[model samples]
Target: MTKKDHEESGLSKSVWSDADLEEMGWHDATVHALFLQPGEMASRLLLDLDYPVRWVPPVRRRDPFTFWVAPATLVFEEVWDLEGSLDFKGLAPELELDGIHRLAPPDGRAEYPLWHLEGHAFELKFRASGFRQYFRQAPRHVAGPMLEYADRGGCAFTEVGFD
Candidate 1:
């Protein structure tokens, strides 16, 4: 998803930007991002299948800890960069599940079975006209354990260390 498409998809373009993300300690290549609907809130954050969910306020934070939205249906995988130049890769001609837009994995990554790679930043779009916030766990904190969790699905566990 290009920045243009991301913007056209209903994300608050004015609120989230590369500079804003940088100031908040995020880069364009942050791992997969989680989304929340307007006024939605959660008390804890789950990084993946392994790490135990920790308490964190889901609302009123400037890019709170890149938490996971449970029930799995709200998470999204993006193949674009928010801090880069505009991409004109127009939306796919076909619309699935009604009017919802889905992004496809790029080139070599197509071979990847998962929806998208972890650690490449997540793009959260609004479900309605309301405030939506996002934050991410740095790769140093999530990569190893999260990958282990994904591989195990549930049987295995990954322990995380605090900074």
Candidate 2:
């Protein structure tokens, strides 16, 4: 991928460029191949905090990784939307280094006072700047103040889209 073609991978064009990312010899497909489930890839990053990944499975395929060793990246137009500049940028990395998992299935729910995390199957969403944990799936019981803070900060969580 080239900086001029940043749109091809649906990465944060503002934060990453094709040319810069190419220096690392990695593509969305390359990371996707490393993980099987949808949140699996992002969870690795969130857990390790070594990279920022946005994995979107192709529209035709319901599964993010069709094979155990699928190395090809899927092409799609949708992307995750994140807003506002980060204040505590170190939060993500710190959390990951502490051995924390920030993804949850719909059957499970976790909360951290002001924030919550929830996911369904392959889908996941986190709504906090630097949470010690993940989001809770309980939609109705979410913290109103935390959500309001997220809203004021241009949506605290990154909105992911699948093709």
Candidate 3:
């Protein structure tokens, strides 16, 4: 679905907008994995927040603000082009995201937007027709190690006796 459609549907409501991301602070967020699909159909970038944010219920406000780390997956659909320099080898190799930016479509690509994902040691540039962010699971009070544990059918916290 388009960004507007996702917004109106409520089911896939965005957890954070550009301004919200900036305000909440996504700098230094850990990127555990980057998945590129065949045929450039889509790409998924998994991230673990460096600084957990306070959780605010949608229906009501609560006292004693609860902080949580919600791992997120950014899906870029209809990827037209993707270029990156990254290595996923070594012990729990991960990238520290400097920032993620949504830029206007490049020339001759009016229908797609360019996404720039910058990290401490790598950079990814892509053009996709659609994009969405999905939280992997319920928020946890503590941020686990920077790794794609959920995708591998494991819970980082559980392994560390934090669950």
Return the candidate ranking by lDDT, descending: 3, 1, 2
Which residue runs of candidate 3 sit more than 4 Å off their true CA positions? 1-25, 40-67, 87-92, 143-163
Roughly what TM-score does model 1 have, to 2 decimal places? 0.18
Tens-digit per-residue lDDT, 1-163, candidate 3: 2322122212232244343444544455666555655564455443333323334343345434333554655556677577888765563556777777878875867667787888777788888765545554444453342334553334221111111
Best of the two (1, 3) by lDDT: 3
Shift of residue 113 alpha carbon in model 2, Å: 15
lDDT by residue for model 2 over 113-143, one digit each (tens)? 1112111112223332232111111111121
Residue-pair clashes per prediction, in order, are: 8, 7, 0
Comparison by TM-score, 1 against 2, better one: 1
- TM-score order of candidates, best first? 3, 1, 2
lDDT of each: 0.24, 0.23, 0.52
TM-score, one value per model: 0.18, 0.17, 0.56
